[model samples]
Target: MKMDCIRTTAAGLAVTLALCSPLVAQTATETDNDRLDNAWSDIIEGEGQLLSPTQYAALNNLAFQAAAARVCDGEKLDSEAFGKAVADILVDTETELTDNEHMQRNAAVLISFGTRYGLFVAEANGDNEKDFCAVATKLKAEPGKVPLFLK
Candidate 1:
């Protein structure tokens, strides 16, 4: 997590979130359940190429969530730094993005990240922590599908 990029991403996210999506904004037609369903649906849509704006947004958030979760679970290897690293992967500002040249990507990350974080915290119906730790242990073991952050 470079300081310069963090600053740039913060500014970009602030502007985008402020102008495009209000954190508390809700339509009369859409309920909280609807939004959650939409978020989950967006995640399902992410299984493909993940070209849709909704999927992109959801993935960004899932990045933040996964990074933060590993860090919070006391499996501290290098995952502590990864929460900030999500911004770097959020948008390749260095490259000429013809497909996503116009819109700000950091804002989508912030919005989706916050939403998923909330959802993760609100989940109390199951032993998610135990399940998450089991997966973390496997990733940390041989096979090693997950590289950095879960060690």
Candidate 2:
């Protein structure tokens, strides 16, 4: 009788663990996504206001230049490729900007930042681009749902 009881308890514990594991992983992924979203928002809001039209154009040129280089090298223009290319441009543009210009130079900067973060979050959540874009679009449309970090 005692052996049977022990077996039942063990089986129950195993079942509980199995059920909870996915939930725990999902929660962790969501938390990470939230963190990334917040970080991106902070960067944009803090630096995006001072960008001039010329600076924005410069940033676009930089991004396109990076993309061209990748194509020249025969690299696949996948999400990671574009993300890294934009990231490189963002860093360079930031350095070139004057100290008072604490802003992303162009729309590409904001879009690339969000794309990179969205790709990361989607991977973590085992989701696809469709799901990611849906969530993002919904969040963007809802006023005050997400901070006004991107233009």
Best-matching candidate per TM-score: 1
Q: List the residue pairs that clash in candidate 1.
A: none
- lDDT score at residue 62, model 2, on the 0-100 scale: 32
Per residue, candidate 2 scores C-alpha lDDT tens digits across 16-101 of 22331233224435544333445433433444323333333333333322332332233223456445544554555434666455
- Local lDDT at 63 for model 2: 32
Candidate 2 Cα outliers beyond 4 Å, as residue runs: 1-36, 48-50, 53-75, 78-126, 129-151
**Distance from true position, residue 23, model 1, in Å?**
32
CA lDDT of each candidate?
Answer: 0.41, 0.38
Q: Which residue segments of model 1 deviate by more than 4 Å?
A: 1-39, 42-73, 77-84, 93-103, 123-125, 142-145
- lDDT score at residue 8, model 1, on the 0-100 scale: 46
lDDT by residue for model 1 over 1-151, one digit each (tens)?
A: 3554444444443343333223212221232322344544454333332123333443333443364354446555455555445544466444465555425455555555565555544431133444334434444453222224434
